[model samples]
Target: MTPELVRELIARGEALTLEFKGEERRQLSENDLVETVVCMANRPTQEMGYVLIGVEDDGRVTGARPRDAGGIDPLRIQALIANRTRPSLSCRVWVVELEGKPVLVIEVPRSCKDLCVRVRV
Candidate 1:
């Protein structure tokens, strides 16, 4: 995605329906990953969501996966989220190479039922 696109999402911050992480670069938190999947599994109609990683504030493209965060590991991550999240969160995780770096890309489609979001205590 372009810098402008990232800026737009960051500008909006967290949505009950969609959450975006602007800090803690290079690491995809378990919570963030789950939120994206839940959004797809039970998100509102006409809503498209995502969990964007490796994208800088300036819209610069960071690598696909960090040396510490292996590209192969994200595949495992996909399985982990699928296994644990209740009602099941089916989503696609792609390791995109941006500017010669690897970044995890997740796309979630809107869901009709089972609104998959709750405020974490």
Candidate 2:
């Protein structure tokens, strides 16, 4: 997504379809991330859900450092979901620059199945 879109989401604040994760301060808990993905996927909406990393709950942008951004691997997230979630789910993860800061965006589509069970992290 573009920086403008990111800003818009931030302005809108967290909701059922959007979550902000401030990874610049601390690493995201694997269990929390897995559970959130499951919950968002199972939500009753046609639109996709978003997990915006490097953003705080209060709409602050801490930003993922360049080194840390390089380490934010989407494949690792996919593997975790594949192993832990029942019926399996796919997500698109990418890094977007916002005012010279890197933000990791994980986009999860609504599940076709009735539920997205989170078996484990």
Candidate 3:
């Protein structure tokens, strides 16, 4: 999915969950991300989905353009997803820049193979 698609989802208040850093920022491990995607897919009628790590859940535009935290490479996140997921779930990762903050956008395509996935990280 394109960055625009991810933005649309956020606008609709459908896809993407804002994960914070420090407070509940339980490290973006491969298993943690995978389980999140799985839970999202399992939700009733939630077909394809996206996960964004940054913004808050209350629609508080806290990020997007100016990525503050360092060392969290987008490529590494993608690799974690690709290497840990089972049955090979197709996904798209985009580094969306909004208001100078960089947000990691992970697009998960609800697969037919399995609805439940275990946390990997």
Q: Which structure is stronger by TM-score: 1 or 2?
A: 2
Q: Model 3, 1-121: lDDT tens per residue?
A: 4656656656776433322221133445555566776665445544556677655575444554332366456666666666676654556767776555566677666556545544444
lDDT per model vs. reference: 0.56, 0.78, 0.56
lDDT of 2: 0.78
Q: Please name the candidate that would achieve the greatest TM-score relative to the true structure.
A: 2
User: What would the per-residue lDDT of candidate 1 be over residues 10-115, giving only the tens digit for each residue?
Assistant: 4665564445433335465667657556655565556677666666544455544452443446667677667767655556666655455555656666654645
Q: Which residue pairs show collisions in model 1?
A: 63-101, 63-102, 63-103, 64-101, 64-102, 64-103, 65-102
Total clashes for model 3: 10
Worst 10 residues of 2 by lDDT: 64-73
Model 2 regions lying over 4 Å from their true place: 65-70
Worst 10 residues of 3 by lDDT: 16-25
Candidate 3: residue 30 Cα off by (Å): 4.7
lDDT of 2 by residue, 1-121 (tens): 7788888888999998998888766777777677878888888878779988789889888875433355667677777766788777778877778877778778888888556555563
